[model samples]
Target chain A: MASDDTPAIRLAGLRKRYGTGDAAVDALKGVDMTVHAGEVVGLIGPSGSGKTTLLKCLGAVIEPTGGRMELAGEAIYDAERGGWQVGDLRALRRDRIGFVFQAPYLIPFLDVTDNVALLPMLAGVANGAARKRALALLTALDVAHRAGAQVSQLSGGEQQRVAIARALANRAPVILADEPTAPLDSERALTVVRILNEMAVQYRTAIIVVTHDEKIIPTFRRIYHIRDGVTHEEAGEGRPV
Target chain B: MAGVYRGMVDDGQVLIDNSGADLWVVQQGTLGPYAEPSSIRDDVWRGIAGIHGVAETGNAAYLTMQIKQGGHEARVMVVGIEVDRPGRPGAPPYLTFGRPILQGHYEAIADEKTGLKLGERVRIRRHEYVVVGLTRRMVSSSGDPMIFVPLKDAQEIQFLKDNDALINERARTAANPAFNRPGVPGLLEAAQASATQARNVNAVLVRLAPDVDPDTVAGEIRRWKRLTAYTRAQMEDILVAKLIATSAKQIGMFLVILSVVTAAIVAFIIYTMTLAKVREIAVLKLIGAKNRTIAAMILQQALGLGLIGFLVGRVAAGLWGPAFPKYVLLVPGDALRGFAIVMAICALASLVAIRAALRIDPAEAIGG
Candidate 1:
């Protein structure tokens, strides 16, 4: 642990199942981990290895079978209350969480600025204010020059970065990246990892990158590996490369 | 209702009298009363002209019933007007063929609907009259042909009798003989009076000056009680609302039902479309987008589809309006109202799809 302060995320006994009886399939089995703020961690697993299930539970995208998960010193999952939030979980995610995916699924109709601004606007921020915030983030992310461009016009890397800017638009304290560099070249993949690391340190964000990308695995000092619904923790070579 | 009667109006441009005045002064509650057997006294125009502001008046007769003209028999509204003074109000706004009844004696004008060619001779009630001119689209309110005839001849045709019936009536009077005075020439007076009165007609037609208030004189005519009169505006209202009110109501009900049906169709379509994109919607849901945002996007798209359909329908209806039989009156206001209703229906219809979209679980995108 880097500091005595509470970690940005704490998880214990996380489990997931699709159905009951003989057809049941357990995806996550009692996983436990802790990641402090300003750290970029990797979740590596093979196909069908519960990596996606864990990410979903972390993002509030799905309910866990049984778990105690906390975010930013707040209890998020209690199997007793059913891992679902009592009210609008969507609002919780929009204000406090961010997500990055394998492909950049930007809204084709809106420009890059608007794509980033859309979340804040949905959260009651005025259009102008939201755009200003989005512009600042895009400038920080190096995609500000292409603010006016439509999503279709951006190159793959630019799109990926724009999507990253969109993810950080609300300045969420946590980000969950799933195979974000899968479609990029080797250089682009490392560039994306470097950008994720810089963003985590700059924003004091806790980022969880789920990947099968072996090239970037050694870059994370802390890595969690899971196989057949069970996870094991390991420390990687503590080097930026 | 007028859509059903569009055939006749499409074919006519003829107005019986171009210089006719403002008021039609029909029977108080009638307009082209073409579906019923109705008539007023021939001399009704004399009193109407005597009214203040009534610039000129003339006798006009209208009979709407089954009439045999040429070799064909169909329901026609026969309007008899004098060649001078005021033109008949029921004359159509357009003329596609020959001129209106601007000719002198023995002239007749027929709607293209009646299939009467120019200069054709037709016999009505045994009175031979020449169709000197052809006219287009002179339709009665009930969607029937309006045949313009010379006033005197129309009166005579309407009044003309069979010789045997007239002779029989004469025989009955002669046989009645109260005094049986030989020098009295028994049947002569009764027969002559009956013959003379038979040619006298049903009602008068009056046209007032443009600036005159027709309602005032119309009120005066109503006071006479024996005669009834209607102004031009009143006549159009009566024709549209009163005369065709029942059919209009029927069509209105159909339109309402069609709108509801269309709304249901739209809702189902939007729902189906949303369901097809369930995974996509789930992804959007998981990404922290609010339900209202997703709902609005679907609603806007549904409205866009409605707007497109309406434009296509309006254009289709307009292009096909002319080829219909009878009269199809596609009023501008009706189209505007239709557009408004379409929009409302689209909005209401989108609600179903929105609800379905909102219900999608965000976890579906993850799918354990």
Candidate 2:
């Protein structure tokens, strides 16, 4: 587990604007946020509320217009520099961040085990070791019996579990899950939230889940709500899954 | 197409290789009997034999004509060699059936490709000859199968005219006033007899002694005997570069066009396949997959498709090769070169797909 004082992710006065000259639109306005180790938080927002823009900035898929951002105790982006602190955002994303989409979106060609093993493989782990790590994660997620099955053979809930397994395959410091339970039933949705909370504590990783699912909303200890282009942090009910 | 050209080019070489001779002596100012008509006196081999470094010499007559058998007719190059002695330079290199021509006048050894059965009677200009033996791989520069007969019969067939033409020529000779002078005695009869008889052969095949240079002997033949002589390599050049140069060029143009079309097709297919996976590619990029990883995936697929195409093409060619009118020479060197070219083309074709995959924005994987 990480030391108590260190944060897994931090952002201060992050701003992003699209285009320029009279046509510019600010997607994120002075967004300030922080996520600590071994924590699971919720992010709820209305349509076009800069929720996706904030996630993109955090995932390193897009550069912020202005901001000071830190990940895993290291400064990554700053407004004064007007750019990223690191040279290769791709490497940072691969080594330090994980993501889960609304859809499971597992690679169809790869079997379940390879779907998880692929991250470590990309990180240059030997095939044997990568597969072993993938098997352990599958077992932890309770989908180990389907490890050798094709993605198409997996059910919706099973596929989501496999996706979570893949996100944790590299043991990244932070995970940004966008609507991780949008298609699940109430029972399955709570199960997914429970698994996410368990994974966060077990791996000492911070997880920020973006969702509109009312069924899984009360499971977070804290929630960040965004409107227009700004975010407001608040305490959650912290209901046990 | 290239195989057929190779076969035509090799036809001339096949002839030279079969003869096993070091030099070919023909009439002055000619490219030898195979490329042009060159009729030298039948006894020229005697003078060539007397040359230093010359081990042996044999007379060879090549006459390409249509021969009739039963109700079928086939064009064949009738080669007249010394049948009295076996294993001569002009003889068929090997016989697949029956015996060599023991009685020279009406017996022949025909290449198997001619479709002539043993003991089948084939009518030439004015004589009926029986096929006594069968050989293989003996063909003319134009890919016509060869029919090996005695040197005497080939000369007769090459020089003799039909009976009507012969009669007309005798009468024309007798009526010429210069020969029919009042007291010419037997001069008219002698002239007719001389005109009817043929005393020329096409060329002479020359074999040199060990440690002798073929070019040196060819130089001596050209300088002393006043005859055109060609070494093996020079003859090959005339046959390959001169005889089939135009056809080779045409085949080369066809191959270039074929390669372009194949590359275009491969590129389009790979590009389409890559485009079909746009969403998957976006997801991969979002997950931090390298650009090279996506590129390698498309490239490997293209190469695999090319390998399958090559295997199917090779099998089809092999199955239909013998059915072609000309021999199709499918050598291992050509097959290997073709495989390498296909792989190169496949790799090049995948570049477009790789570029498109690289351009996919990782942000697309997340909704706005």
Candidate 3:
């Protein structure tokens, strides 16, 4: 029995080192952060900082050398074990975590509906149920009209919306977005930010957006500035959508 | 029916010659003139006729010779048939033009493949004969053309020696004390005379009555005559299984090499297609697609390519098989077996692509 106030995602002293000995590079010395449910935080940094590394650690794409990570009140990694606690990391990523890349990266052979439905399918949901869930997400993201179209047939903004729909399909507890709006114009970028904020609150999902784009920087209510493989939290303007 | 022989009996109605003949006597396991010649005396036919279940019999001689025509020599199998009787066992089944040989000597009927026109002179041994008829597909088992000649003429041409060789042989015999003794002067002459005469034929072809059993007759011939006799089935086995065994082995080796080349080509093509989609594969892995799913996709694509190739190959073979010089037997069983083999090869070929795809790291999808 966990309390209602438990954070959606929490990291305490997350460390990742690339190699050993004097030639080794420490990508993330120790990253500590927390985001509650229904919160959207911005992870901003310079080029050589550990923004990408921290996002990868949270997304479970790469293993952190030493860390304690918690998702929805469960400890997924502990520094004492030196690895993830889950038996199958891939299943954890499929069922609990969502990712949005700089590029849409939708599978070219599938239509928009299939692209969004794939996440639920991978988690062993039936085909009809998965497609229904995908359709509901597309409706929420305002891309339902293009659900039957091929990924190549969609415009840039439409592709981004579809990608967002995919990220929200499985109702994951957390979403790690790596520069999701970098390729869009200023107006389109703000629209994407507003959509992300709405979806976060609507689904009660905690999202961390890693970006260097100046257009949507002020949209975040809380911002973590990482430099020299470390993070410092600061409050944003908290502008209204 | 195209290569098999059918000849007219005394009634002038054509029937398969093997069906008309109850038993055939030849050297054991020899079916064509390409092998060493075997002969039995003409008197043996008399012994064969007296056997039970034996009805009527004819004598035939086989010899492969080089026939000179238009200043070019061609190898042909000369068959000696009885010119004294019409519809003899050794006669050509049918003729397309001209007439059968009416004279006992100095006349011949040739297969169309011999390229002999009517009234053209062909020299065999020390004699010349005019071609009187042309037959189609009257070839020996090994596809050599057949030339029909009178029995006595064929025996002489096959056995007679040249004048110089004969003289030398006689002098050599005379110098040997065992054969040239003055006490047995007539003995040497008797031997010389016997050597000049042709008293033997290669085999006796026997024809039975309508109600007779050929297997029983063949058994009696072998028992009483003390010679090898063959029923049609036995002869077919000897010709197809024993005589052509080496040729079958050669064809089997060719098929093995072709299968290996097909496997290699399929592996290369599948590997190239898999390489083209490496980025997509990494993304799929990052998105939690299992390794088996990716492998199955590649395997199915490879099998599809093989199916397309097999269909095209089968159609091409069907269209061009008749144009080849030798017979090309393409049966449905062979095609089905070939399809199975192609599918198995394609499945095995996709393994290389699968191994490469499984090694892709999912983290590569994220930069750095």
Candidate 2 lDDT score at position B77? 94
Query: Distance (Å) between predicted and true CA of B155, model 3?
Result: 7.5
Instruction: Give the winner by TM-score: 1 or 2.
Output: 2
**Model 1 over residues B85-172: C-alpha lDDT tens digits?**
3245434344566666665556677778887788787766766667766665566665677777777766766766678877776666
- Candidate 2 per-residue lDDT over residues A1-241, each given as its tens digit: 4367788888899999999999999999999888998999999999999999999999989899997899977889987976889998877877788888888888887999999999889889899999999999999999999999999999999999999999999999899999989989999889999999999999999999999999888888899999988999999999999
- For each candidate, give its TM-score against the true structure: 0.71, 0.87, 0.71
Off by over 4 Å in 2: A5-7, A34-42, A103-111, A146-160, A180-198, A212-223, A232-241, B1-10, B66-75, B125-127, B167-195, B311-325, B330-333
DockQ in order: 0.40, 0.55, 0.40
Q: Residue B305 lDDT in model 2?
A: 85
Q: What does candidate 3's lDDT look like per residue over B1-368, in tens digits?
A: 11111110110111124224557776554552223366877678788888777777777888887777788888888888778866666678678999988998999999887889999988888888889999876666555678889988888877778889788888877777777778876988877776677877887888777788889888887676767787766655555556555656666677788788888999999999888878667767766788887898789889999999999988887887655444455767778888999999999989999999899877766653
**Candidate with best TM-score:** 2
Residue B310 displacement (Å), model 1: 4.5
Model 1 agreement with the true structure over A136-195: per-residue lDDT tens digits: 989988989999999989999999998888888888888989899889998888889998
TM-score of candidate 1 relative to the true fold: 0.71
Chain B alone, TM-score of each model? 0.76, 0.92, 0.79
Better of 1 and 3 by lDDT: 3
Ranking by DockQ: 2, 1, 3
lDDT of 3 by residue, A1-241 (tens): 4477999999999999988999888989889999998999999999879887887788787889997999988988887876788888888877788877787888777899999998899889999999999999999989899999999999888898988888887889898888989999988889889999999999999999999988888889899999989999999987765
Best by lDDT: 2
lDDT of each: 0.75, 0.90, 0.80
